[model samples]
Target chain A: MKISLFATCLSDAFFPRVSEAMARLLARYGIRLTFPEGQTCCGQPAFNSGYWVEAKEAARRLIDAFRDSDYVIAPSGSCISMIHHHYPALFRDDPAELRMARELAEKSYEFSQFLVGVLGVSDVGARFPHRVTYHPSCHGSRLLGVKDEPLTLLSHVRDLDFVPLPFAEDCCGFGGTFAVKMADISAAMVTEKADHVRETEAEVLVGLDMGCLMNIGGRMRHRGQAVRVMHLAELLYEGVRMADERA
Target chain B: MSGHNPTSTLAERVRIALNNDFLRNAVRFTTERLRTNKQAAAEQIGNWEEWRERGRQIRLHTIAHLDYYLAQFAENLRRAGGYVHFASTAEEAVAITLQIMAAKQAKSVVKSKSMVSEEVHINQALEEQGIETVETDLGEYIIQLAGETPSHIIIPAIHKNKAQVAELFSEVAGEPLPADTAVLAAFARSKLRGKFLEADIGMTGCNFAIAESGSIVLFSNEGNARMVSTVPRTQITMMGMERILPSWEDLEVMATLLPRSATGQKLTVYMSAINGPRRTADGDGPDELHVIIIDNGRSRQLGDPEFQEVLNCIRCGACLNACPVYRHIGGHAYGWVYSGPIGAVLTPVLNEEKEKWAEVANASTLCGACYEACPVKIPLHDMLVYIRRRNVEEGRTKRTERLGMKTYKVAVSSHRFYQLALKLGRIGQKPLVRDGQIPTRLGPLKGWNNVRTAPALAERSFRESWQALERELQQEMAEMSPQVKARLEELAGKRGDRHEQ
Candidate 1:
């Protein structure tokens, strides 16, 4: 399919490889991938921070950027939810803005949602011999209503042992600006999440969003923990393609 | 800043809380333990979501027909010889309560944990009237002794460590006490049991007031709620207007959801449904039962679309456990009776000063974990945004923010202005850029970048890079497999239709 990638500002600056891996994997599935450059952010920071006007402006830019795309797929569940669920509310009183928001919401999909729902492929003939646990990002699990798609795909991976992380649905406290704004509380929350990870005795931890993975990964690093964090896309991209083709 | 001010900003109060290193640590330990227990319990339940949904539906139904259920509840309570009073405001509620205290000639009172009482600052009012009021809930008692408000709903003294608690208890015991849960609990039980027995009045918060039976339900892990309800000659129950459920059938769903969501228990140590004061035939119940239903600004949201669902909250503290904001700063930072996602919405919506409470809404990532954790399925994230929108709509945002938004609104409405702004931004950000990241923690970026650097604008924006790659793919496809190209078009067409549909 002609997939317009909203690499999300986080991926653009820090995790470009997640964006690259997504492109290659979808391309291998014979999908035409396009990038719409007019995008900057989904305007979540402003929106979440009570800056409605700034958020509306950002949302307008995002909608305009992907207006012509066949499918607007974002790697982050939180941001995609912002577009799909919240953007419409931002323009609740204005029919024109509301209409534009509805279109964007219809087009937007999280990376995993796009892969599992739109593409309808649970198995990519991938193999990974390791024990891993998954942390379902709050937005994806609750807001976006993606409960088992990621698990459905993961369970199909060959030779992989999936140990369920206790308190897997509990937030790891990477609340965008919330980490810094409430540093002590955030640190404590992540500590509990880290403990849960340790309890699982899994060598690998996988999640959908890089923001959460980064926060949990950073804390894991601080504690000198050996558990490695990987995005679900990277795992699927691993054995689905030849070594050199994998991002 | 306003009438009867507490002599400190909410931020200042939180600062005091934060400085108490002991408080911070204790809160961390308690919340961590509670969160873990909740997870384990949910895991054991298996069909946790279904139960949550059923719980949510019951609440939704009850709240939707609140007037009908409340009337039924009050009628049933009255029929059972319970006196039911509805207070339209905090002042009216306090007046009614004080009137009852006077009529009973109450000298001493014992209380169970009640967020509604906290909202009314009932103890402060009672103390001013020369009445000795004792908080019986272990956590509430600790905070009451410390002369501080509760920092958490479930664990009121969650902010105090064992040593601090021992110190507080020692002062009352006239001797040194050990910093042990068992020892402290025993001391508290002994001390509070006397107060419960001697007190003229017993006060408790109603978790749910069943409409059909005219009963007030209390879900407590500790037995104090029951003790307070049974021992005193007179029982006074305080409940928010939203605390109504239609029937005992719905109570089954609530019984399932409340304990599991709150502390992840299959059942609390005690879940009592008191129909009225002690019956003529019953031996150990309160002789006189009085229920005070307080609106206290809750009635303002009765028919409002954006906020009506907030009334469905069961005070289970599940949202607080799931909230990233509360997970970080704890409850005091919220600066109000409620905290976490529910608090963020409630503090402002319920408070008269919209400006003072508006900042609480900014404390979320809008990630919606609270919605997931909520047994009643309140869309707190969405409500947070609505609160923000109202702040802007009412012209409460700062001047700088207002101006910035004006410029943003103008620049983003069209591609022409947007392209110019982007080109300008790329050049403008150059001076602020350092080490492939925007290091300027100034203006709007201050709040975000205070802890993490803003990643610099990508060397090539994703949109720019994708266009170049797509162009290359188009040419390469002309020389590539036709079957693959056809499949690509077919899938793309299907996706497009889905988007349209």
Candidate 2:
């Protein structure tokens, strides 16, 4: 089975460590991940901004990139959500691309989803002693219904003190272009999210999507706070490394 | 109403709202309390999803056959001694209302909480003709006293605090009334009772119009709707054309959903259905009832695939409480009669100049929280995108924003260009990058940097490192275990996705 990586553009350009961590962690189970070079983006930025014509142009390339893979996984739930939730409608005009879009949607999965649902591996023999809180990005949890898979994975991690984020489901306001277009409103939203994360008083803030994590983490940094922000994949991988070093 | 575009642009309005700490905290506290109560109420009545779907189906069926149900409702209402008028425009609705007021020679009209009346600017119209119009509902009365429109569908004065309410009431009381809830309620109750007795007409907004029974239904916590409908000699009901339910049975679903979603009550304190004008034998009720069904751009949405489901909204304000944008800015920032997720969609769709209301749609993050919270399952998040698409198709978006998206299209069209763009981004950030992060408050980063640090591109992108990672992984590669492989194959055979909303 050819398992491919759809390194969402944000993960590809800004947080490459997320994909690297995902690749290393999945490799522990003998799953060799394939990187399809043709993929660039899921076209959510254009799609959300009402430029479906351009969004389709961006999406067609991505759908074709993973056409041959048996399964495609991404570290960010938002990107996978864009593929599975919007791609079919994005390509609705062309029947051929629509079929490929549907095919791509079926094979694609967010990282923890691919881990727990497909591999049936909730516990990856990882240990993290730090207190952490998770921010469920709105797109990932609401659009994709990826509510439990991440929680299940976190629950299985040894010695990981996880405090649930207050108002965990509220948007961090990193809505693709929304952060720029409606910046003030977006700032207010992220400010509230940062306040909640602070309320948790956790050492690290973990979330599924880089978009949300970046927004909240950026706000935390601006406020001169030292709360480490990480992708769930990166957190789990670091936990594995911590356990390995102890061993 | 307060949403009458007082501040001009949405950005300026949002700026003002964000700076108002008291308004933000008040909205946040109330919405949080309401949201928690709604969740508890919905959970206490198990299978909330089933109820939502049922309410959605009934609304869908009724709307799909709107013309048929509306005709039946009109005829039945006429037979039950109620006059029925259909208005296609806001002007027409107001004209019909004014004509009725003229016929009744109404000097004063007492009103319940009627969003439709607000939409028509009826109070201003009535006042222009030298007739008195008073809001009888507590929140509506408070906002009316402040010379503002309702900021919320259910909680009209959601943005106002008790002190503000006291201020509004003290002016009417001609004394220094304390900013106490009990004192304020007593003041309003006594003050409104006099108007209700002296008014020549009663006015109301219908929650649901039952087609089979020719009845108008109202759900209110204060019982003010009952007084509004029963007090005056003549009664006027203003209903949106889409507020029809096929029968009383369908209203049962709505009755269960509306109050719970609005304020987390299983049932409103007062639920009334007026079959028609008071029967000849009836001792107390409006002697003459007039039903004015107002279209006001609603008929345009009847067949529109993208926006039709928006009508499924029961005006519960659940979406408002769920919306993060609304939580920060409150209702007035929407700059129209409706606010929150529903307002974002409705303002653009229900107005003639779509371009003018375009920015209202951008206020949301397209977070889909509203859809999740909607009791009738209206897909507001998707509808917002469609509204934005309409704006884009008509050349309503900013030229620079359009150009930016077009440039983005070119960059992401192929992986090579996308890589080249990232390479450019990395090099472009060298001067701005401070210890691996771009904290500069310059250029496009101004708004973003004002609130948070912008991340600079990584030293090496994932794809740039993929080749080396693959070589390292090749040496460690092993065969997948049998059980996992079988699970993968089994998963590959299925087609339906749980993500399909």
Best by DockQ: 2
Query: Which parts of model 1 are misplaced by more than 4 Å?
Result: A7-21, A36-41, A51-68, A91-103, A121-136, A146-242, A245-247, B1-7, B13-20, B429-434, B438-451, B475-501
lDDT to native, each model = 0.79, 0.91
lDDT of 1 by residue, A32-92 (tens): 6677666767887677656777787778888888888768887789889888778877889
Best by TM-score: 2
- Steric clash pairs (candidate 1): A1-A31, A36-B463, A37-B463, A185-B328, A186-B328, B278-B286
Model 2: per-residue Cα lDDT over A1-247, one tens digit each: 7899999999999999999999999988889999989999899999898999999888988988887898999988888988888887777778888888888888889999899888999898889999999999888899998999999989988999999999999999989899999999999899989999999999999989999999999999999988999999999989998999999
The 10-residue segment of model 2 chain B with minimum total lDDT is B492-501
> Per-prediction DockQ, in order?
0.31, 0.84
CAPRI band for model 2: high
For residues B145-200, write the lDDT of model 1, one tens digit per residue. 88877767787777678898999999999999999989999999999888988999
